[model samples]
Target chain A: MSETNELKVREKQEVAPSAELTKPGPVFTPHVDIFETDNSLTLLVDMPGVKADDLNVDLRDDILTLTGDAKPSLATPGEKIYGEYETGRYYRQFSLSEVIAQDKIDAKLSDGVLRLTLPKVEKATPRRIMVQVD
Target chain B: MIYRTLFGAPGRRFGASLKELEEMQQRMDRLFNGFRDRSAGRVGVGAGVFPAINISEDTGAYYVSAELPGVTSADLEINVTANQLTLAGERKISKEAADARYHRREREAGRFSRALALPGDIDADNVKAGLADGVLTITIPKAEKAKPRQITVQ
Candidate 1:
């Protein structure tokens, strides 16, 4: 009876390990500040080490992908006595809802910051109705 | 009696002399000029502090490009370790003036660093870097195992 219980426990652990492996890896969420205006939604993403030429923003179907690379700051080989930040490639993805107008989306990168302007679809925006008096 | 009443003492006479006053004025003028010279070059671009880089991937390799306008080839450094790539440089602006009045100066001058971690593992040894038209380009070839391969069906 004890042998059967041990086998069941082992099988359960193995199944959990596989399940975890199939899950998505950790997402490197960029620091983003979103603002909604009358005509569009402005998204500002802080890509500190990124350069304007290196940034790529793509929208396909409902998914938006942001990819870029950042170069290191030191030229000659020296002892890195103190360092906190890890400079590397940046990747982020976001799923947009139907309210977004894909065709009107515009993006710009300046000074390592990426700004995306997402316009809402006409029908998605709120409309004002006129009232007439008889 | 008149010299004693007017000059008082030798030290006082020296301090109140025209030559001494001229020397003190020159020292004060030098201090003020130094302050003006330092403050004249203070131009700050608050939101403009990041380098620009471009990256693209093909079937076999990944390409990255960056705009380093004032950076010289000797000032730039590129390194690739495992799947990470970094580009770092220092931008120094040295201005000499014989008799030039400043109208307006707006340029970033300081040390700048940028780094990017690649998505997939790359062959570090095969990476190549080049600079053209103030833009630096780096090509990182994908590893054999990391490259996409077509499998044949038996």
Candidate 2:
């Protein structure tokens, strides 16, 4: 019951609070997934409807920014469509911690998917030691 | 007589042959134009369409690669079912102020999904995925029977 109440509250908050209220401005938001492996941390971002030449990735002052644009589909006059997916530019930002290796980060974009590989610093990775017995 | 046999009647033969010849010419023109368009770099999903991918058996593991240019690792979802592999996610637009006007927008956006049928059955529990430089590389180790083995001779 409490959970349902909370969800209802959330839904209410998302709805417009009043009539004549201005619509919110467009936001630059991108969905991202992070995974960690033995060697590196990988990030995959989807930037569909975007071309390679229009993407930009940068890391500045511990903040990583990814920005790109997506082209809209061509619409003919008097054409009737029944979908509500909008294509536009994409923007996302991430604040990095000291644990991340800033200098060795690698990024690539292909087929509308962006991938980032961040290798851990030497001191951050686990080291195995061999023990010998006499 | 020949016209009657060719078109099922005498008067309609010329018209039918003319229409047939026009269609054949149109088809030939389309074929040539398609070749020319491809040579001009207009093939396979145009400028913003993502690349279609296929994974083949490589050594001891399954290799997966997808063409996702201008995308980073932060925007991907990969899942493996019993015998199917699914890649689904969205790419957002670049963030700018509300008043910014785009002159030439040509990137793909919104959600995209790709599913692959594995060549051989795999252990979904052990599947692994990696993304580097806009390419997603998934490595699925072959099952016990699927892996190559050497028999002993007595």
Candidate 3:
């Protein structure tokens, strides 16, 4: 790896408790990258150890909520000797703007990463307005 | 995960009130979230390591696991020699369009190298690794001489 390509380590941060949750476990705020194009917004969420059936993505009243539980699927049975990380669930929420088409949003989970595509509302799509001359 | 259940280290207990206090602190942190640059993954505080790892041991082998979300096996390189295990990989995330506007950018992409010293010698030829659900798990069996043998209590 080149000097510039060296990856700096960043510890995982837990999501602050903002509401009453029944589940009991450390909930991490998954890392995410969000970008927008002319017609849609793309969100890439990193959620390692979470399976497709264990993830939940909900959008209600313009609020988008994501939750996933990380379970040990690989059989690496042994006594704990040392641990640099703790297993836990992931939770995050984002309030969408009016431009997003909440009903048209789509989500896919692959290799522990969740990709969400949120298409814009029809009238919100960006387009150049041509001037009409007299 | 089984590790979560196995993490009952001695002397760390949280009573009901203490748990409530933790929740209160978390709520306060969110209140002042704007003051901190939370958009960058590099700035967040937690365990303070990239691709957090865990190690476990059985009578005959040692198991090591690391989180590498969105990273494929093709990008990773693992080497074990004597008692050291070196994990080197480049995490390549698809780049956004040049004109694409970003609302929030936290996930990062780059090369990372981590070398861990094992507790005992390993059978390098018998080492096995697998990547599933973005987690890389390596099982390293101990060398014949490194394995502890129980003598018959004659």
Candidate 4:
């Protein structure tokens, strides 16, 4: 096994209890990766076992909240011998900056990963103005 | 924390006293394991956590599920031996532009391999595996000799 390429297993981070729970189970904060380009900011969120219809993405007053309900996959419950992780809903929030065009944001979910693209406003995009010499 | 065998067996749900004991045992296990995890200096860092798994069994088969967000069927490889099941896969995150600046990066991309010792002999020919929503579920049927048989009382 290559030491550098080995996958490091991290336990899921549970959402803080300070957040009010709308549902009855443990909620976890999904891991996320955010990057910004010249035109837009992209967020990749990992929420395994969540279906597209069960996910809710809400944005208001520069606060973006993501909630996904992940149902148990087993149709028939069996004797659980060993479990490393528990099934729960995923919840997280991020406050956006003024430069982001909230209305123009786009979201897509595929294979348990949610990708959000927030386009920058025209004023915030970098533009090079050519100097004219008469 | 390392995984532990859950207390209480099938059909024990009606035993309230046993159920309470199970819950108490679970709480105590967590309390002590939390200390062990911290002392090992692996708390929060998750030194060996990857593709978290859950193993369970019914009368006829054993089931194993792994959480592998963002991984597709094309990147996974599954192999089962007489007493072991091996999962090997690679996760790839699309590359962004050269000028892209990362605000936070927690998702990872790489190859990972894990081999588990199955509890009983597996009917390798009939094992079923499927990947959906980035989670992989493997259904391993127990071998004929390993499966429980109901013997009539003579």
- The estimated TM-scores of all candidates read 0.37, 0.38, 0.76, 0.78
Positional deviation of B60 in candidate 1, in angstroms?
Answer: 1.2
The regions of model 2 sitting more than 4 angstroms off are A1-134, B1-51, B70-74, B152-154
* A127 Cα displacement, candidate 3 (Å): 14
Which fraction of the native contacts appears in each prediction?
Answer: 0.00, 0.09, 0.66, 0.69
**If both were scored by TM-score, which would come out higher, candidate 3 or candidate 4?**
4
**For model 3, which pairs clash?**
none
True contacts kept of 4: 0.69
Q: Pick by lDDT: which candidate is best?
A: 4
Candidate 3, superposed: residue stretches over 4 Å from native: A1-4, A73-75, A124-134, B1-49
lDDT of 2 by residue, B39-145 (tens): 64223332232334434465466765554555456777888987788877664555533543333233444656766677677778898876543445567776777
At residue A76, what lDDT does model 2 achieve? Answer: 14
**What is the per-residue lDDT of model 4 for residues A23-84, given as tens digits with 9 covering 90 to 100?**
67778899999999888989999998898988998888888889988887532247877767
Off by over 4 Å in 1: A1-134, B1-49
> Which regions of candidate 4 deviate over 4 angstroms?
A1-4, A74-76, A124-134, B1-49
Model 2: per-residue Cα lDDT over A1-134, one tens digit each: 12111110000011222334343322345556665654566667766555667788887777877877664322111222111123345777777653567788888776566777777666745778889898
lDDT of the candidates, in the order given: 0.59, 0.57, 0.82, 0.82
